[model samples]
Structures are given as structure tokens and as C-alpha cells.
Target: MITEVAQIEVLPGHEDQFEQAVSQAVPLFLGAEGCEEVDLQRSTEQPGRYRLLVRWETIEHHTDLFRQSQGYQRWRALAGPHFAAPPQVEHLYSVLAP
Candidate 1:
């Protein structure tokens, strides 16, 4: 499995709105193909900061499948304005080490 992690920083004073928008946006992720799970978290210390963790069957499922789908475009239109800036996203995978 592959994990996509994003550190989202909401604009000052827009935290509440951001959270509300995210609540609405969650369904989009949940409905996507190859999406195993989606988890959203907020920072206790940094009130306007959030972490979005999404698990996919493979990295291509996100970068190629989802990103190329119409749902992603619609999602972007809905959620784009809420961001303070473009989110910092990273692709990750588990490591089992000896």
C-alpha cells in the first residue's frame, strides 16, 4: 500500500471554515477508486494546521488514476479556495527493518 500525506495550513481565522469544508470534502476521497482509507487530523498546538493521511493500493492510483479523474477536478474546484496555499504533499510507504 501507499500513503499520501499532506500538511495543510489554513489561513488565519479560517480554521473553522476550513474544517467545515473538509468535512464536506471527505466524501470525495472516500468515493475514489483504490482509496483504502482517509484520515484527517488537526494539530493541538498549531490550531490552523491539519494533517491528511490517505491510503491507496498504489501510488499510481492517486497520481494517475485519481488525479486524472473528473472527480479530482471537481474536488479541486470545491476545496482549492480554502487552502492558505498549495498543500505540502508527500508519498510514503511502510518500511519493515531488521
Candidate 2:
């Protein structure tokens, strides 16, 4: 499986709204094809910073499928306004795990 990590920075004073938006958008990710898991993490040192982690069966499941689906549009619509800037996203594969 592959994990997509999106580093997002919310606009000042919009942190709570952004978090709520993410929560509301969870189903969009969960319902996508090949999506296995979704999670959101906040940076303790920077309240406005967040990391969105989504695990998929393959990289194409994210880049070629989900990103092209209507759910992706809905996701952006729900969470886009709160973004301070475009998120930095990357994908990773597990090398070793317990």
C-alpha cells in the first residue's frame, strides 16, 4: 500500500474551521476506490499546520483515480477555502514495520 501525506497550512484564525471541514470530508476519502484509511494530524508547535494521511492500495489509486473523481472536487470545495496556500503532498510506501 501507499500513503499520501498532504501538509496543509490553514489561514490564521481559520484553524478550527479547517479541522471541522476535514472531519466533514472524511467520507469523501473513505468512499473513494482503493482508499484503505484516512487520518488527520495537527502539529503541536503550529496549530495552523496539519497533515492529512490517506492510505491506498496503490499510487495510481490516488493520483489516477481519486484525484480525478467527483469526490476530489467535493473535498476541495469543503476544505479549499481554509487553505493558507496549496498543500504540499507526497506518497510513500512502507519499507519496514513491526
Candidate 3:
């Protein structure tokens, strides 16, 4: 499995708006092929920061979704203006078992 982590810094006073937009946009990713699940979380120590974690079957699947689908564009349109800057995204793979 692959996890895509997106660390976002939202503008002040736009937290709820950003969350709402992400809520609406999540279904697009969740509905795509190989998307296992999606998680949206706020930083406990940072007032205007958020994190988005998306689980995929593989990195290839995640890449294909971004490269071939319109969902990313829609997602950007919905949440782009709320961002203070571009999000920092990282991909991770599990290396240890629980």
C-alpha cells in the first residue's frame, strides 16, 4: 500500500471553508481506482494547518489518478484559494508490521 500525505497551511479564518471543500472533494478520490481510503485532519498545535492522508493500492495507481483524471483539477479549484501556499506532499510505504 502507498500513503500520500499532504501537509497544508490554510489562511487564517478559512479553516472551516477549507475543510468543507475537502469534504466535498474527497469522494472524487475515494471513488477512483485503487484508492483505499482518505483521511483529513487538523493540526492540534497549529491553528490553520491541515493534513490529508490518502491510501492507495500502489504508487502507480495514485500516479495514474493524478495524471489521467479530472478529479485533481476539480480538487484544486475547490481548495486552492484557501491555501496560504502550495501543499507539501510526500509518499510513504509501510516498512514494519503492527
The clash numbers for all candidates, in the given order, read 0, 0, 0
Off by over 4 Å in 1: none
Question: Which is better, 2 or 3, measured by lDDT?
Answer: 2
Q: Ranking under TM-score, best-scoring first?
A: 2, 3, 1
Per-residue lDDT of candidate 1, residues 1-98 (tens digit): 99999998888888887777777767888788999998889999988789989999999999999999887887777667778889999999989764
Ranking by lDDT: 2, 3, 1
So what's the TM-score on candidate 1?
Answer: 0.89
Clashing pairs in 3: none
Name the better of 1 and 2 by lDDT: 2
Better of 2 and 3 by TM-score: 2
Question: After TM-score superposition, what is the CA distance of residue 57 in candidate 1 from its true location, in Å?
Answer: 0.4
The lDDT of each candidate is 0.86, 0.96, 0.90
Candidate 3 regions exceeding 4 Å error are none
Model 2 lDDT, residue 14, Cα: 96
Instruction: Give candidates' CA RMSD values in order.
Output: 1.8, 1.0, 1.2
